[model samples]
Target: MLASKSIKMSKEQVSTFPNADELLDRMRKMSEDESLWKKSKTDSGVDIFEGKVSTKYRQFRGVGYVDQPLATMVSVVKDAEKRKQWNEQMMGNEVVEDISEHVKVIHSKFNGGAASNRDFCVFYTDHLSDTEYIDAQTSIIHEKCPVMKGFVRATCLISGTRMIAESPTRTKVFYLGQVDLGGMVPSFVANIVNMKQPLCIARMRDFAMKDAASSSSVPSSASTSPQEEKQNEEK
Candidate 1:
């Protein structure tokens, strides 16, 4: 449990959390080592795997394909507000500090039904390239955010999504999460929840599909009249 304090740190101070490159290296190693994980089940098109780690909570990974470009999928993951709309468990998410254009300190709250609510303060970062996109986050102790009265402070050991561009319209997605939801949560209950965690990838894929559909439905700039384009640009 974290002490109740309202201390704020400078951006330089918060930036000391682990960077994206190091975390990406770890993610690659974990994902590539098949011996460390066992196939759990497949939901929709996503295949879920469960593995043991240093924490009491098991680490789960989901592998699947989404019918959206890497860039579009990246946009969907990066949009924090949009995430809350699809993730029913997410109660709140906000940026606590900006470490860089790609790295940030994020504070997120979750609704733990039948148990106390949970929250986490983590360092979030992402890397995008022509071939692959990686977004990762890990627990971080920030003075600005502490365990509130009604919530338990949870630790996000390591979690994120990795997307590999398969084609202009398709991407291979990998989602991993290892979190310690600190409290008296029973092992059986935790295991059940962890098993379903991978379903989130399917939800994400559906969300991205809808977003792509909506974007495609909008009129392109080329279809707009010169006057309308000028007015849109002016606005």
Candidate 2:
């Protein structure tokens, strides 16, 4: 018997194939090439994010996919442009101009909760930028905003799960397919994806539950995420 730890586990069992080997073969045939997602490549570059986004039908399920909407993604590109303008004006430097130019538009029609707006914003700079980063790090509380000092975050956020982690290119779930995440997935996958250790299924359930809570299909705030909003709220 399987472990009884699963939530809402069904008594009905699933026994496909004659034996273990057959099941393995079936799974193997259905599985995608591991290498396909191994490269940890960025989607379009700037739209390196994929989370839950609303569609014509409002979803209460938290199972949103990342990086799959053209119009929404293009908006993100435009938002990056605005932020770039702001950051450049602040820095008086040509840094952060071309940071998120390749944001892709992943289509998220049936993921349920929201389409995963997945993409990456890699800021691999040279010595000057690195030095400025160190300066900001040293200042800590004194520093205004990290981006103000020429740092671009490579972070991921699930529409429902919230922020996954930072700097870890490609999501682990990007390996296998992700879950439906119910309706309320917590809307924070990007922050959550970068976590060193993976969260148990129970935790994922919680994220999905949160997504179910905020069933409003209304789009979230502008390019700035809920995290950014909270940070601004605190400030």
Q: Which structure among the candidates has the greatest lDDT?
A: 1
lDDT of 1: 0.80
Residue 186 lDDT in candidate 2: 44
- Give one digit per residue, the lDDT tens place, for model 1 in 20-53: 7888888877766888788988889899999955
lDDT of 1 at 229: 78
Please list the Cα RMSD from the true structure of every candidate, rounded to 1 decimal place.
6.9, 23.0
What is candidate 2's local distance difference test score?
0.25
Global lDDT of each candidate = 0.80, 0.25
Our model 1 lands, by Cα RMSD against the true structure, at 6.9
lDDT of 2 by residue, 1-235 (tens): 1111133324243111123233233233222233222232233221122223333222111111222222222222224343233222222222222323321122111111233322122121111121111000000111112322222222211111112212222121211122222223443442343221122222333333343355456566566887888999999
Clash number for each model: 0, 75
Each candidate's TM vs. the true structure?
Answer: 0.81, 0.17
Residue 211's lDDT within candidate 1 is 81
